[model samples]
Target: MGLKSVLSKVFAARVNRELNYLRKNAIALQQKTFTDLVDAAKDTAFGKAHNFAQINNYQDFKANVPVHDYEDLRPYIDRVVKGEENVLWPGKPKYLAKTSGTTSGVKYIPISKESMPQHIKAARNALLSYIHETGNADFVDGKMIFLQGSPVLAEKNGVSTGRLSGIVAHHVPAYLQKNRLPSYATNCIEDWEQKVDAIVEETHNQDMRLISGIPPWCQMYFDRLSAKAGGKKIKDIFPNFKLYVHGGVNYEPYRTRMEDSIGFGIDSIETYPASEGFIAFQDSQKEKGLLLLVDSGIFYEFIPSEEYFNEKPTRINLKDVELEKNYALIMNTSAGLWGYSLGDTIKFISKDPYKIVVTGRIKHYISAFGEHVIGEEVEHALMSVAKQEGIDVVEFTVAPQVNPPAGQLPYHEWFVEFGTPPANLQAFAIKVDKALQTKNIYYFDLIEGNILQPLIIQSLQKDAFINYMRSEGKLGGQNKVPRLANDRKIADGLKGYIS
Candidate 1:
């Protein structure tokens, strides 16, 4: 066989080897991973303060570490920012990745020397796994475009700081960097508009065989590229483009738009990496959910979503998890975060290979009128209706219109940005509403009891959500419009927007 064929086979073999090993020892590996993490941070101040030495296994560790959001860990992270060693981990953090969450602004998550590799390895393996599964490794020989935050990292308290993607960009293997598009200078432009313009100009003609980024920003890039190339579909511009690796947001709403941009179907790989750790990734072509990373430097725990808001929720590990139930993801990583609530929810779709689907954020859902609807339901509802009506959703958010002005009743409000609108808009809303009522029993009951009126549908002007995000000063780079809000704060803001 030729050298290219031989190399492709070798890459497949390597990834399959890891996959086989994981399949064989996943349970034991998960158990040992928790042990390793506990041992590593048992002596840190945060660990010592929690009496980590006495923690022997997942149960003890969970009881001792206490599930924490960024706010709960802020004080300890602030100490790490001040040159403190062994505060959470053994040494000072190499950098702090800054993220301004829509609900909570300005969260600084620490990235340690030990935890950085997990991010890099998980991302690398995700691609490798896809390559092996599809038997397509030739794309590695060509250029790839990664729409990441500016590679220009800022400094705070003598520690490097930047977006998580920006930090990962810094660690892209040097060989691969040679083919990555949007040169360093272009990526450094802080203003997203300027950066995107420069990116379109710089590499619209490059031999790009791969593309990776958050869905919305990448969609923006694709649209601009098409516009600049005289209405060329992305596939026409980069004929060799083979893979689209996406993360940082659910890709469902953007799927139709992205496919339309390319003008053809393409394979995609989804990753569940966060600033906290690289959690899970799509490891199979036939599979529907991400395979949980068993050997990554992070250990996993799950709290059932129903009990997540309880005074004391049940947190379980791999051995005890069940299928088809939504659970809040809790993680402990070698990176010094012990029992941190990553704020995301997931549902296991498989047990043999240990795969999961991201359900949504712990705090991101709508239950405004006693109709508890989670992210998974909303996404499924949108995707179902969009597919049935042959439309493409750009972005959307749901909020309940509570407190009726007079004789009217409270109902759910849907603000949808559609790329393709059905001719009958009334039927479109009816289909979407019926889909939600089917998925969520609570919502169905409200409708049945006459406690809630029919859902209202408002067509969002194109880029309405984008404009709202831009107004928030968070136009791109991992920033997303929250899929569901508890209150009308975001809904009202979007109403006042140009959309």
Candidate 2:
């Protein structure tokens, strides 16, 4: 083994020990993080406005501060963007993670100096944990690639600003710089397709062992590689590739096709990260969910997802969460975000060390007819049926078809791009509809009452989703199609590619 690979094993052992301590003292670690965040920000403008000085406990903090979405805290954020110091967090934010907002347009989330290391640490620990568990550090000697947005950042009020991934790209440790793939110049290419082509040209013959990105972009990279190699499997192109690290979306929908593209199943690590904070990561391959990072520089709160929109929803601390129930993830971060709604829902699978699975987005659900179908249910239904029928799904989205054609009942419309088309499309649709009904009772009741018909599958042509995403100028870099929507915006846009 090379010196770096030997050192990686040693580092992995040390990190695993620290992780065990954190897991064993999960509640205590969370309590300390909570207190630390409140105390650190108590002198800031928001702190003064919210009575943070007088807060002594979780209850005190909760009573003093209210949960805030971007708009709710925009006034303070606006000041920070205008170069105001001590407006939100301590003095000045180190960087603002720019993200596209739905209702609010462009959103700038603060990333403080203190909070920055937490992101880097959590990501590093995820890999180290994998190395420790599997005793595989040989990949450390090989090239690694992360498909991401350009690293070139812009100045906003004298603070560096860019997409979270781009901001993170600037922080890759010096030790790994030599092993990282896709030359900086290639990565800086503005267009994602061009970037992928450049990346392929630069790294196809290298000793690639670790590949990381959101699954869709990784799929795109694999497709480009296959085309270049005359349809050869990805395993043939990079025989040493050992791990596939992904986040931002559930991997189940893309799992079958990704494995097929690679010609084998591979180990994957799922992480739960956001502009707000690095929340959790897969610490064990045998575990079912990502281990929540109780020791990270963020304090967590959870509101029962069903009660999220209700007036004054019940918010509870991490220690109060129960298994199997979904909750809207709320956080108080060192970045000066207090009671910030992350807009994502998660369900705890294990409480011993606080492990969770990303369930869906709070806003991304279909309830046009009051059925309230979520991303998890739809993904589960679709993948389950597809598995039983021996089919391969490339990508899919679900939107309510409230207005159907003449003489037809309104129903849920599923836009599915199939890698392997079913021999009987109607039978496949029936199986998926039945599977969905079993997952959600509301949809089942609606179907039985004739309020909604069984879901109709709009089989898409090859690369339909890729084309749609490209047309919308969201081809890559943390972009993903919503699994379920209440309206037909995406459904309408996808009409042209329907087979």
Candidate 3:
């Protein structure tokens, strides 16, 4: 066998064995993970304050450590930034991943030496697992272009900090460094537009095989490459391209445009990596769920999405989860974050190896009319409507029209940027409205009671979301517009640029 074929088989065999072990010993693995985390942090300031040494099981851990979001952990994080050792974890963190939410404000999250390897390993394994399952290793023989954020890092209080993608980019295996696209100088350009132009000039003729990026940015890269090649499809330029690994946003809405850009359907792998930790990734091509990393140095807890906003919420671990329940995920990481809210909601699709799909963000939902619509429901409604109407959704978002122009019942306002407009515009709106009514009972009742009017469909200018994000200084790299908002924030903002 050729070297590529031989290495592919070896990796496939090793990943299969690892997957089997995780599946077989899931419970034991999870319990041991909890035990190890508690043991390691028992004497740190956070652990000591919470009496971590006395914690012996999931019950004890939950009872002592309260669930927290970034704001909740700010005090400890502030201390960590001030060069405090053993503030949250056992020692000082070497790096911090800076992130911001839709509402605005920066969150500096610790990346301890203990936790860095977990992120790296999860990313590497995500690609390897895909290769193992699909027997597609020839792609690795060529270059894989990771459209990453800048690799240049900044420091604060003797600790380095930058975008998670940037930090991860710097640590890519030296062997792949020879084949990874976007020169280090291009990655350091700092301006998104300038970088894209530089990237286009640099990669137009390279023999690329795999592409990884968040969908919108990937869409932008593909568009630039195609434009430079004079309307040629990405496949025409790089025939060897095979895999498209993406995350940071739902890939469904962007699928059609992406396929059109590449001129073909390429295999894709999804992951759920956050600043807190590398969470999960698509593991089986036969299955639809992402395999949760059981022993990946992070302990997990789940709060039912319905009860998460309630006064008293039920917290469960690996041993107590059920399939098909909406959950707000919480993590106690290899870093010293105890019960930190990742802000994302997810649903379990499989349990043997603990597989899940990200449902939405805890705050990224619309219940404006008591409809309690979640991100998963919005995605399903849009996809269903688009499929039936035979149109392609480029991007979309919704907000409650709490106050309309009078004589009209308040309802949802949907801003859609379509790749291909439907022949009958009313049919598109009807389908979108009808699909939501079927999925959400409160929405159905509001429509039936005539308390809410038919949903408004406002066509958005092509690149509206990209422009809006650019205005907010979040044009590229891990930024996304919330598909559903509880109020007029996202909707009003987009209305300013409607087509």
The best candidate in terms of TM-score: 2
* Per-residue alpha-carbon lDDT of candidate 1 for residues 232-313, written as tens digits (9 for 90 to 100): 9999999988789998788888888899899887899999888888888898888799988899888888899989989999
Arranged by lDDT with the best first, the candidates are 2, 3, 1
Question: Candidate 2 at 263: error in angstroms?
Answer: 1.5
Query: To one decimal, what is the Cα RMSD in angstroms of model 3 from the true structure?
Result: 1.3
The lDDT leader among the candidates is: 2
Candidate 3 residue-wise lDDT, 1-499, digit = tens: 3476568678777977887898888889888999999999999999999999899877788789999888888899999988889989987897999888554388898998888988888888888887777777887678778888888899988999999999998788876788888899998888898888898888888888889999988999989988889999999999989889989898988888899899898899998888889999998677898889988888889999999978789998878889999999999888888899888999898887789999898998888777888888888988988876679888999888888997889988889888887887777788888898998898899999998987888888888888988988878877788888888877878888787
Q: TM-score of every model?
A: 0.97, 0.99, 0.98
Ranking by TM-score: 2, 3, 1
* Cα misplacement distance, residue 106 of candidate 1 (Å): 1.3
Better of 1 and 3 by TM-score: 3
Error of 3 at 495 (Å): 1.4
Error of 3 at 425 (Å): 1.6
Residues 1-499, candidate 2, lDDT per residue (tens digit)? 8899899999999999999999899999989998888888889999999998899999998888889999999999999999999988998899999998878999999999998999999999999999999988888899999898888999988999998988998899999999998888998898999999999999999999999999989999999999999999999999999899999999989999999999899999998889889999999998799999988888999999999999889999988899999999999898999899999999999988888999999999999888888999999998998998899999999999877899899999999999999999998999999999999999999999998899999999999999999999889998899998888899999999998
Backbone clashes in model 3:
0
Per-residue lDDT, model 2, residue 465, is 90
* Alpha-carbon shift of residue 229 in model 2 (angstroms): 1.1
